[model samples]
Target chain A: MDPASILLGGFASGMVLFIVSVGLSVTMGLMGFVNLAHGGFAMLGGYVIVLAMKHWGLSFVPALALAFFAIAAFSVVLERLLYSRLYRAQELDQVLFTIGLVFVMTAAVTLGVGPETQVIRLPDWLRGQTDLGFMTYRTYSLALIVAGTLLVIALWLGFERTRYGARIRAAVDNRRMAQSLGIDVGRLFTVAFALGSGLAAVGGGLGAEILGLDPNYPLRYLVYFLIVVAVGGLGKVTGVFFAAILIGVLDFVLKIYFPKGGTIFIYALTLILLLARPHGLFGKRGT
Target chain B: MDAPHTAAGQLARRHRFQWWELLPWIAAIAAFFAFPTYLAFGTQLLIVILFALSLDLVLGYAGIVTLGHAAFFGAGAYTVGMLASQLGWNEPLSGLLAAAAVAGLIGFVSGLVLLRTHGLTLLMLTLCTMALLEQAANMGAHWTGGFDGIPGLSFDKILGLFSFDVLYFRSQYLYVLAVLLLCFVAVRMLVYSSFGQSLTGVRENLLRMHAVGAPVRARLVAVYTISAALAGVAGGLFTQATGYVNLSVLGLERAAGVMIILILGGYGRLYGAFVGAVAYMVLEHMLAKAYPTAWQLGIGVTLILVALYARNGIIGIGEALLRRLRGGGQA
Candidate 1:
């Protein structure tokens, strides 16, 4: 592969990772709950998209929107029923609970969809390659890059400029202050968790073309996403974005150059980064 | 400090064990030795018990919520398998030593990174380490035998005396039991030592320990390394017992299962890990035999109930019940 192509591929992959991980970062930042089930939500989205498109013959756009909404809805129920109880519990309890949910969701999917690998076929429009001046790129990947960039910008503006975003920021910065100021902190938490889950779902739906849909996909990606969240710094959106891209790019470059030791290379990178900045690349101290 | 002294006082009280307390444990070990003939499943249970005990050393006693404890176990198994198949080291002791050494080194190195972070970060980092190792194992298909796993690895006599036979499950069970006894004693001694107290102190309050001039991080790392070594020993024994080593040993599911075992037995208690392991394996065996596919669902439900209601696990619940029965006349 050309250097440019590798870079582009890295960029595209990073965008997918960023989308998947930012939700986890947000939830961790806002709620201080290490929601390991974030990957489950992503898997749920992937399975939903695959099922909707393949079995129900829904179009990509509708299926993606439906999957996003479905995961968001699921998150609401999860927040009310499970996460509320877990918020004040010890970190281990939260982890165990989320880990349990991972198994349940995985088993549920396996039971419903069987264990076979399901491919989410892209539409004909997304199947073509675009002729750039220097390199030819897949239209869908390029489209994803554009969409991901737009999403990031929108998220940035929403969080930084909007009143609801300020309320969320206030809640995250100081729960008591936010509540004292008459902001509904409980509702903010639910909304934030829902948003996080929804973003993961979106990432899952979009990247299903590349990642593929499988029952074990969530467990596999869970650590990678967490690494992104951890390395980027919890609750720091920009940190997640940069960390995801760095990891995605590094993973791609290493995999292409040293296929045998790609995983070791990734781990080595993480270890180095962690040693240098234990709080992560963008995380603040004590957070 | 006060809590530690109180706990030490409680430990002293518990050490004055009645004849009945000793009888049950002795009978349990005896049954473990002799019960393999009744069912081949008992041998498998023995190995799992060892695995769980190794976990308790770090999790239960040291208060480390490690999700990657299986890394050492898997590494140990792979090391033994690789050594036996490639290097032709049929000596089980040498294999076990090699496994333990390698696992201990990895544990020590990673513990430096892991011990820095508390709670969720440590949990996630350990999981990452395990995941990374599992991927590396999978990627190194030629060396580790990949998904199909390394087979055809056989052992001669364990320590040049005990012959391992596939048909005779009794010998294998005894071999595992002997190793388990040695490990159990060593772990018991370690837990009773000052080092063990330091670990508990670190777990209870790192800041206070640090302020008091205790090397909390070093103690934690040491405990982690020791736990990893024990887990490695268990893994090496597992390979010897089964004549197979697979990548699934290091997988997340196995790690999660170990956590479940810790929960089932009761954390911080030496024998809890053993009880949890036995219960898990027994329940899994029975449930799988009966339900086949949905057995995990049953296990999942059971774990949820245990986490929610039975905070201290099955052993704690049993002890509570026994206490209630003993005090019934007073009430």
Candidate 2:
């Protein structure tokens, strides 16, 4: 492929990563919850999308919608039942709990889906390439770039100009103080978590074709999400977007040049970034 | 329950080794002599115990959360594996020491960078370091065997005294037990030392330790190096006992499992490592034998329950029993 095609491919993957990782970044910063199982929700989304498209004969957009809303509803229940209790536990406890949840979800998917890679039938529009005089690009990539840009813009507006977003910010700043001011921090957390999970579902459903859908997807892709969150500064939506693009391009460029060494390059960069800014490139200090 | 710094350290040092404390070792020895068939599992348990003990040092004692400690373990394993497989160095005891030294060097190098961060950053950095190292090992697949991994390692003898028999694991079990005891005692001293006291201080409060002129970074690096060396010894023992070493030693699963063992046994307490490793390995053995296909589910559920409700683990229960018995059932 030409250089431009490779770069666009990287950008498309970056969009997928942004979609999956932004939620983790926001929730981690807001609640300091260290939700390692965010990938679990993403995996569920991939599975949902596959089942919807293959078994139920739903098209792409409707399937994506179903995955998002279904996962969002599931997140509310998980937040109330399990994650809420862990908010008060030690960081070690929270880490282990989420890791455990990842494993549990992995096994559940393995059992449910028979431990094989699931392939989805995308619409012909997605499979077709958009022709240009100089080069051609996958229609899905164009869709992703457009969708990611739109989603980020929408989320930015929501977070910056809405009452719900203000409440989440205030609750994140100081839970007790927010509650004292009659913010209903618990309800706010539940809402924020559900929304984050919903976005992750959308990302997972859309990105499955690029990233692949499998039982072990959660664990395999965990470090990527975390790298984005860490690099972007937890809780900064804009920062996560930039970090996702940076990681995706960096990873793609390295892989194109040195296939076996790309993961190390990305991780080494993340490690160095964290050493320089442990709170993240744009995250608040003292977190 | 909250006091985990100097007071708890002193209490641990002063607590006498009672008969109940000796009971486990006695049973282990008896099992070694009587149940010859179980020696394979027993030796593996002892190796895990050593690994978990190393983790307990950094995690339990220093309050560092590590998801990449398998770096040292894999280093040690690869050290011994490469030595016996390629360099014609077959002295198991010396190989173990060399492994420890190599792992300590790794710890010193990485800890310099990793110790600067804490919490999730520290955890992720360590993990990133592990992935990088594993990749480095993979790059040398010509010698290291990369993803397929290096196997078929054989040792000559233990200090030129005993030869290793493939089928029977008697000598291997005894040697591993002796080393485990030696390392356990050495670590026991290190944890109760003034330096170890400073470590707990850093763990509980870095600023206070630094304010009190405790050399916080140096203390952390020191304990981390020591812990790496001990874990390396475990890896060395594993390589020798199994006559096999692979990249799986460096995988995230082993690192995560070791941490789970420490938590299951109770973090920080020395015997907790011992108890936790034995319990984990035994449970794994039984569960794997029974579940076969779903053992991951079993372990997953157990970890979730432990993190949710039983963070203190078996050692905590033992301590509660001891306290209740001494006070005649009331605090």
Candidate 3:
């Protein structure tokens, strides 16, 4: 309808994508492991929120928090048991293993909760529209913007400013040298993985309503996540954020204006950009 | 090609033909006349195996990572589906011909652009191509049948002689088997040919290939086209046998399903496609029957285990066992 509504809606869409894809982008960039099953973690987080609210009688915020933390904790186990062993394996191996994980997660969800979409109840205050100056807007979208911005600021600070962040950057830039400098690169990998997985959960929990929580969530949405990573540049936080927003706005605008021709434009943009700039727009050389 | 003579290490690089090579043909022939009741399922598996075989050419032999090969497959299926229903050209052989031509044309055109990229970017490009095609098909709902899918496909008799029988399904199975065998032989020759060797060179070391005067990009595009053509054949056969064409053939799940099958049977091995197809389909049939709702979990778990431990697939495992036995016998 209104251009302003469309723009803000695009912004909200972008933020959720950022929340979903940031973890995937960073981990892939850092470890050189292509985790095709990254969306499976997001699906897990979405289900956690739905499960908590529906069965445990918890509200949205607390249920979402619980989902974020629980999936984060669970991811640590996955990193240790499975992902750690394959850090040095071939990229193809990593892809296959993660795809297998995706399958396992999708099938598990299907069996556990049937094949229907999982829905969570929100507070009455957040259910409907809020009157802005020119037009009414969804209250939840505003909440998402605030939350996503806060998370982005925190991630930027943590990634760019802190000493830990420096060590991670150094390790990513040159792993062997970082190891020689006694950086404990393996331990660094584990921590980075956990952080990414945790962030993924938070994004999934918060954006569940818009993205739709279902057993097929991972398979359905994984391409979008990967698109964010590829178009933004792997392991670059700011790149992922910017690319996600751009992609989100572009996707929404295209879909609203022209429903039949959205994926072509989005996918073609990624392809053309990749060809023109191999390491991504914001990435370093030779990545 | 002359075999390279070297020390003990080089012996492991040699590829001696094994008796297992004949196993698929023998089984194909046996099932040709034997399985009248289960012929339909058997025919489906043949199409799947052929699809995997095409993927193996690009993925296994050429070392290309493709995620949207289903594009060519859907192209072939749609081509044949349209030819039979719309154009009224239902000759089985010509239908296969048209499928291969259309699918091959798409493959060659796309491969030219895609061969310039490598690794994950190439994978994404292939994926995008499929997404675009699928969208086009979805948007052209009036002709392609959109979500409801294109059904009511009926094929003419094989060479105007062998009519498709209802009870036995012998003609259909026989036709599929004959084509599959021909394709297998063609692929076998291609892989062992000089071009295949140079293609492997590009896969192993592109810089060296360039230095040594090999046209690496062209070779890749050629292999990719051949692979697409084979996959197209599978798609055409699929609709002819099933009497329907669904857009799901172009989906991510279908692409991943074939990739999983290729891995299970072992990539790059000639007979690996057959072995992998048989194993994957049989397991799927049995597992789905046992756990209707959760059979996907079984496939997923099997894939995980195979990827992690059995990296070289069943054929590689067999080679290792054979080597170990030989060593023990010598000792």
lDDT of each: 0.81, 0.86, 0.85
Clashing pairs in 1: B60-B268
Task: Tell the DockQ for candidate 2.
Answer: 0.63
Q: Report the lDDT tens digits of candidate 2 across residue range A1-287.
A: 67898889889999999999988987887778989899999989989998888888899899999999999999999899989988878877787788888878888888777788988778888888898677788899988989999999998898889998888777766778888999987787788889889989889888888899898888888878988888898678889999999998888888888886558888788888899889888877874
Show model 2 residue runs off by greater than 4 Å. Answer: A173-180, B1-15, B320-331
Candidate 1: stretches off by over 4 Å: A54-56, A173-183, B1-11, B16-40, B135-149, B319-331
Q: Across residues A1-287, which tens digit of lDDT does each residue of candidate 3 receive? A: 88888888888889999998998887876788889888888889888888888888898888878877888889889989998888887666777789889989999999988899877678887889989877889999988888888989998999899998888888867889989999998888788888788778878877777888888888898889888888888788899999988988898899888887567788778878877877777877763
What is the Cα-based TM-score of model 2? 0.94
Q: Write the per-residue lDDT of candidate 2 for residues B1-331, one digit (tens) a residue.
A: 4447897776765745566767767887999989999898889888999999999999999998989999999999989988887888989989999999999999999999888887668888999988887888887877777877777778987878888867879999999989988898798788778887788888888888878887788888999999999999999999999988887999888898898888888897878888788777887888889977666787778878888877687787788788889899565
> TM-score for model 3?
0.95
Return the TM-score for each candidate structure.
Answer: 0.91, 0.94, 0.95
RMSD from true fold, candidate 2: 3.2
The candidate maximizing TM-score is: 3
Model 3 reproduces a share of the real contacts of 0.59
TM-score of candidate 1 to 2 decimals: 0.91
Model 2 Cα shift for residue A26 (angstroms): 1.3
Residue B163 CA error for candidate 2 (Å)?
A: 1.6
Write model 1 residue lDDT over B42-75, tens digit each, in one string.
6666666777888887887778888888999898
